[model samples]
Target chain A: SAVISQKPSRDICQRGTSLTIQCQVDSQVTMMFWYRQQPGQSLTLIATANQGSEATYESGFVIDKFPISRPNLTFSTLTVSNMSPEDSSIYLCSVARDGTYEQYFGPGTRLTVT
Target chain B: QQPVQSPQAVILREGEDAVINCSSSKALYSVHWYRQKHGEAPVFLMILLKGGEQKGHDKISASFNEKKQQSSLYLTASQLSYSGTYFCGTETPGGSNYKLTFGKGTLLTVNP
Candidate 1:
């Protein structure tokens, strides 16, 4: 199991602004995942961040709107750029150690874009 | 495709039981169960990796039927702490994908 922590537990931002959320893991992981949960909705995978390689994004989510950076095995950052009211949601960082099926998640950052 | 969970919401009194079901149209390699309380991240409960497999932890158990591409979560003698939203995530038939498409979730409210 991995222990993860995300910065800015909750933030209220205005539209057109950008917010960068940082995720830190206690141990090295092969991959880190960014997920978004809209109000009263299920989690949607935003991207898969792998160290030294470009992040893999899911359909409907683009790098221009949500830029991801993985500088090392234990750290990653996701930036929600040009935010809008529709971007208001909870962002969670999750990590699963290689060879393990269980994923551990950090306390999510709740962003309300007004 | 995202899995579908039935009984969008359930209300139960403490000590009662509840079951949550998740089904998918695509073949699955694994099914993961998670419970999330308000204002918190979802916590992993268990994962079923094979057909007709059942796993349990302290009265909270789950079964996966690979043939049907469906899974069920059983919470027996539910406690107050069990009040939360439950989600089932399914991974398509590949370990390499590592991407899980989650269900809409089932909201379970346990009244005292």
Candidate 2:
């Protein structure tokens, strides 16, 4: 099992502002992932954050909108740029632990863009 | 591709049991189960790899049917804490890639 934490448990921001959510893991892990969850909706994958290379985004997401940075093994950040009301959702970070098949998730950063 | 889960919602009483099913259109290398409480992130429950291995956590257990290309999460003796949305994520067969296509979700409400 892995312990993951995210910054800014909840926040409200202006429509055009940007927020960077930080994710930290207690132990070094492989394959960090970012996700988005709208109210009453399921989790949607945003991208896969690689340490040294560009992140691999999902079909409906782009780097300009949700930029990711994985500078090291234990930390990563996801930035929601120029947020809109539609982007008001819970952003979560997940990491797959080594030597195990489970993926642990951070508490989540709940952002309400108005 | 994403796996399909059944029973969009379900209501159960304390101590009752419920089963959530997840099936994929494509063959899966592994299936992962998670539960998300309201206003929180999804918590990892268990993972079932190919070869019919089963794992359990407390009263919750899951089985993977490799031949059927499906997996089922069984919540036995469910408590109010079990009330949450359940999601099944599928990992396709390939190399060491760590991508999981998740299902929509199954909302479970456990009442007293």
Candidate 3:
């Protein structure tokens, strides 16, 4: 299991502002992903943070809204751009080790837009 | 597509048992289970591959039926610490193997 941590554990932001969440893993990993959990909703995959390339986003989610960057194997960032009240959710980052079937998650970033 | 989990919510008493089911419409390569406490990230429980295997940890066991495109998690002799929301993440073939589509979790509350 990998030890994952996210910055800005909880934050309150004004509408129209952008906030970037950072995920850092203690050890190097091959796969990193970003997920969102709305209030009382299931976890939704926002994108796959590919190393040195653009992230693969799921339907209903675009890069313009949730841009992600994976600079290296142990670190990644997800930026919630032009945020709105509806964008408030707990953003999580997860990492998967090579040859393993489990993915470990970070202590999610809870964002509240006012 | 996202997997569907049954028994949206259930309550179990100590020493009792319960089962949670997850079903997908498409063929699945794997099914992963996780348990999340309130305000915490989901913790990995177990993973079942495509070969129709059953795995367990302590009193928690799970079975995967590739033909039925479904999986079931069984908790025997429930403990109070078992109270949490359970989620099943499904992985399909022909895409990023690591990408997982999660189901709308099942809430389990084990009472004394």
Choose the strongest candidate by lDDT.
1
Write candidate 1's Cα lDDT for A18-78 as tens digits. 9999999999998789999986789999999988889999999999999999999999999
Candidate 2, overall lDDT? 0.90
> What tens-digit string does per-residue lDDT give for candidate 1 at B1-112?
9999988999999999999999999998999999999888899999999999999999899999999999999999999999999999999965455888999999999999
TM-score of 3: 0.97
What lDDT does model 3 reach?
A: 0.92
lDDT of 3 by residue, A3-113 (tens): 999999999999999999999999988789999998567999988886867789999999899888898999999999988999989999998777875989998999999
| Candidate 3 CAPRI assessment class | high
Query: lDDT tens digits, residues B19-109, model 2?
Result: 9999988888899999988877788888898658898999999999988899999999999999999999999887355788889999999
Query: How far does residue B62 in candidate 1 sit from its true spot (Å)?
Result: 0.6
Residue ranges of candidate 3 with Cα displaced over 4 Å: none
lDDT: the better of candidates 2 and 3: 3
Alpha carbon lDDT at A3, candidate 2: 90
The candidate that achieves the highest DockQ relative to the unseen native structure: 3
Residue range B4-77, candidate 3, lDDT tens digits: 99999999999999999999999999999999999899999999986589999999999999999999999999
